[model samples]
Target: MKVAADHRSGNSFLDFLLSFVADCSKFQSGYVALIGKPNVGKSTLLNGIIGQKLSIVTAKPQTTRHRILGICSGPNYQMILYDTPGVITKQMHKLDELMMKSVRSATINSDCLLLIADICHPPEQVLGTLDEGAVNLIKSKPTLLVLNKKDKVKQSEIQKKQEWYEKNSGMDEVIPVSAKFGLGIEEVKQWLVSKLPLGPAYYPRDIVSEHQERFFVSEIFREKIFQLYREEIPYCSQVNVVRYVEREAPAKDFIEIEILVEKESQKAILLGKEGKALKTLATAARLDIEDFVDRKCYLEIKVKVKEDWRKNEELLEHFGYSGKIASASL
Candidate 1:
């Protein structure tokens, strides 16, 4: 993806200041959860901030289902960002309820909250007057309001939304950003570093996320489903990595994944006429998975019907939504 080049560069005075700050005793580290309604560019913002894509992105809403942790560490600070599922006002299924549970857990566990809103659309049209859960969380935490999609909106419009958030939401600060074009990202980093509490690094500086390789592999397939299919196909489907194995020397890694659907008709839709659609999806997903693992992969994909799996607690747990966000150092 195209992004802005780093503006911080070689200047004797700036270098001296950075070195001085790095050597200071006041270092900062903590978790900051990114919370907002669906399709508000939360995943895109996280990818831009962390300088990598840990969470999947699509035009479709509710693409992210779990709490994904993206770590950003500098010489004197480490900010662990949690990209959570969008907070839905109405829980339509057991899966929706589980996703909301993740939002609540991330909000409660984080040291600071980053609430994002799409500035290209009206607040009521994009975020829809804050939900009670969101309102309570904002009231309780040190929150930052982020106006995303600034590249698509005018400065006057952005300012209007910023003022509206300041008045209605309990946000401590407002920062306008364009996640796609990398506008105002430096300001966001500086603000986060200032707000973070003084503490040691929670994760190793080299690592970018906490999830396993298999988890990302499944997510890649799920993202392909979202990108290729339409209507209820993406919503009623889930990807599970049933088997994953690594090999040495002259051998390729092996991965077996199952695409679970709620009905037989959905399976047919995914498979497509003459299995052309499934082949296309598998090729795209395999390429991404290979790039992620840095190895050639032999992938096996199958479609299965698991009626009402979203509402089944057992199935949900098996799919890795354990009804609790795993504990992380804040």
Candidate 2:
């Protein structure tokens, strides 16, 4: 018997040719916006789907303040996932409006939307229902009802929430997933791919996100703030990377970061007794920064009291939260 060297057979040359042909076939690519209320695991879900830490995840709400784009490419599909800030219930400061604007911008022109809801809450809770802003955003999009944190809820509760969303919300599909544990993520990816139109890859296959290293570096420092602080401290704080200097081989990279707070008391709190707190925070952040840049990092963190910085338009823009709501309007 003669062995066949064809594409369908176990032939390396023919297999490579067939794979190339498949790559050149019609590919699905589009932007998907992940919108939800605070602590709904939007960041976690995005990181889980993309298989990287593109968005910072903390136990606190509103950790994501801008529109973050994370790209995930497969053999035949490329998903540009937009992880926006959580919907703000009350626009307290200019920063709040800016965050909401990000959500709006992310929703506009998106190929698909994932409204992630926390299923662990009871149906009567606000978490059970989508906010007006979210509802309006979902009305005209190919939306998917993603009930995240499925691991925290019972099967009966999951069914109830899914049924409620299916009836009350006009989502095309309802998926239950635990972003932390990676359950039902494959289904989420499949649904996103199904909704994407046939097109060429939007970004390079190896690229995970469009943000530069400084953006992620700032987020890492902010994540530490949220992790270490309590009450209104984290919410009132913002991290700014003033100088990020990279040196050649055999030289350690230096990063100078400033943590801005609204009051001197907050600044003192951030510095802690004899700057011990800041030192601990810097050490923790440096370890992660080293891992991210794959180099030895010397991180310098300072606390500054920028009184009412959240309300200052110039400062907000400097902080990169210039409210661009009008630009997002359709």
Candidate 3:
């Protein structure tokens, strides 16, 4: 069954399951992609709307490296939200460029584009901040300019910021919200629903995301690396789920996983003295994963250095981000 709710027949178990399906106002379903420069709270907004931290959030720039999916289903419709990487220019590493391309691709056919702008300043304050390719996206699309971190700013400052966007942006609308405070999220949901075209729900009510449990596990670990190390580790990291086996020991039904990085030196830093740091990350991730999935997970994380995998086109393509990049660069 695409969505578990479809099987509901008022059977005791099914009846309870049906009520758990998410619902919004009666409206058409669609996709929304959150886009912006690094550290602008796009991922935070996704988590707020879904009421789950499906997308990792950190203060560090470029915390999100690729498109992370989060799905929300309300009684009337389902909306898929893509929390994408920050758009920035970098010629040294091809993966950086490809990351921006993923953001562009996610924007296409998106019913609502959440253009996250930090509320502390006006868009002009970020002049020359947007790369050519990234700026081109805002120039053409119907986007919702979300002034994130609204709670951190004064009301007068927010209006000033909105006025700046009105003069500068060609997007459909601009709204202020604080992703951290979970403020204005429901309104954002309603606005996005109104924008989406009327159509059948693409996914079932029970499905929360398109990725497997293993993928979420990898993300949790990656998030820890990003959160704990920030600038030191994020730029040099990549988390791969090498093995994910489901355990059905009744008392210990769980999953096992491994996290892969890019350099031996980096691995050394991640593993830490007596392998203590890795152990800490795994322990924290295991609990969060268990809570998110509602099942026990025996997460095993090993740090391995692949040596400049991000810089190699072949490796990047294999990991699914280098769709247009050539093979020779590897």
- CA lDDT, every model vs. true structure: 0.84, 0.83, 0.73
lDDT, candidate 2, 1-330, per-residue tens = 122445446677666666655765778899999988889999999999999788999999888897888999998899999998887678899888878877877888698899888888654333334466656767777888899999997898888888887787667888999999999999999999998987778788889988778888888888888998899998998888788899986889988888889998998888899999989899888999889989998887768788898888767776667532111100
Q: In terms of TM-score, how similar is model 1 to the real structure?
A: 0.87
Error of 1 at 197 (Å): 1.1
After superposition, the stretches of candidate 2 with alpha carbons farther than 4 Å from their true spots are 1-25, 124-136, 323-330
Q: Tell me how many clashing residue pairs each candidate has.
A: 0, 0, 6
Candidate 3 lDDT score relative to the true structure:
0.73
For candidate 3, write residues 109-216 as lDDT tens digits: 477778888888646534255666656655565568788898997888888888888777666777889999998898888888777866668887787788776667
**TM-score of each model, paired residue for residue:** 0.87, 0.87, 0.82
Give lDDT for model 2: 0.83
As for model 2, its CA RMSD to the true structure in angstroms is: 7.4
Clashes of 2: 0
> Candidate 1: lDDT over CA atoms?
0.84
Better of 1 and 3 by lDDT: 1
Error of 3 at 31 (Å): 2.1
Question: Could you tell me the lDDT of residue 85 within candidate 3?
Answer: 89
Clashing pairs in 1: none
- Residue 87 Cα positional deviation in candidate 2, in Å, after optimal superposition: 0.8
